[model samples]
Target: MASVQKETIIDADPADVWAVIGDFIDGPTRMAPGFVTNSRLEEPEVRIVTFADGTVAHERLIARDDQTRRIVYSVVGGTMHPTHDNASMQVFPHSEGRSRFVWIRDMQPDDLAIEVGAGMGHGLSVFKQTMESPR
Candidate 1:
């Protein structure tokens, strides 16, 4: 089992940050260049992203808690996913009108979990950098 969590403080407003994060398909475009091969709308607004490395992950808008500004998303299923069962989250918070992005990935096991989770944490760091850097 593995678990990874990453948090970043951005100077932009939470809404501005969510504007970028909401584009789930753009995760590859903005989060990691060349990482996402393609993404399709599974339904009205749900998206499934296929990675260049062959990981197919599904994401749906689980819920939007306005009070917390937390955009809940989940991986219903995927191939070569972080684990046989995987779940993640993107927590958005407004601190002094700035956006604080929190990414959390929960997977089972210990050793392998840290490896995968750390990789994810690094990826999320890239995402934060790209999203916040004059884009």
Candidate 2:
């Protein structure tokens, strides 16, 4: 499997970041507003996500740890047909009023890692911008 990891420091409190990202059903759309246009729960552990690019993905929640501020999910069905896809995002306290965001994705077929990584990079940028903006 190919693994891709992306991390960034957000100029926001860890608790604040967790409050947005910890929401499994609405987190993506909330964190990266335009990037993730919409997200709705289909089941207790499953959600349908729609991206700004008009791509849709059916994701299954694997685990969510509020204590650790981490969420794990897998892409069960999506526009991109990957053999396997598992992703996790975690938030950690950084400076006095800042937080660290880390995203890691593991997927089959090394070639797909490039595209996935690029998307992740953009997503992180959007997330950071959103988190730092005034509420």
User: What would the TM-score be for candidate 1 when compared with the true structure?
Assistant: 0.70
**Please, what's the RMSD in Å of model 2?**
0.8
Top TM-score prediction, candidate number = 2
**TM-score per model over all chains:** 0.70, 0.97
Model 1 lDDT tens row, 17-70: 676565655644556566556887788647787866777877766665555655
57: Cα error in model 2, Å: 1.3
By summed lDDT, the worst window of 10 consecutive residues in model 1 runs over: 80-89
User: Model 2: how far is 86 from its true place, Å?
Assistant: 0.4
Error of 2 at 24 (Å): 0.6
lDDT of 1 at 103: 69
**What total of clashing residue pairs does each candidate reach?**
5, 0
Q: So what's the TM-score on candidate 2?
A: 0.97
lDDT of 1 at 97: 67
Judged by lDDT, which candidate is best? 2
Task: Give the distance in Å from residue 38's predicted Cα in candidate 2 to where it truly belongs.
Answer: 0.9
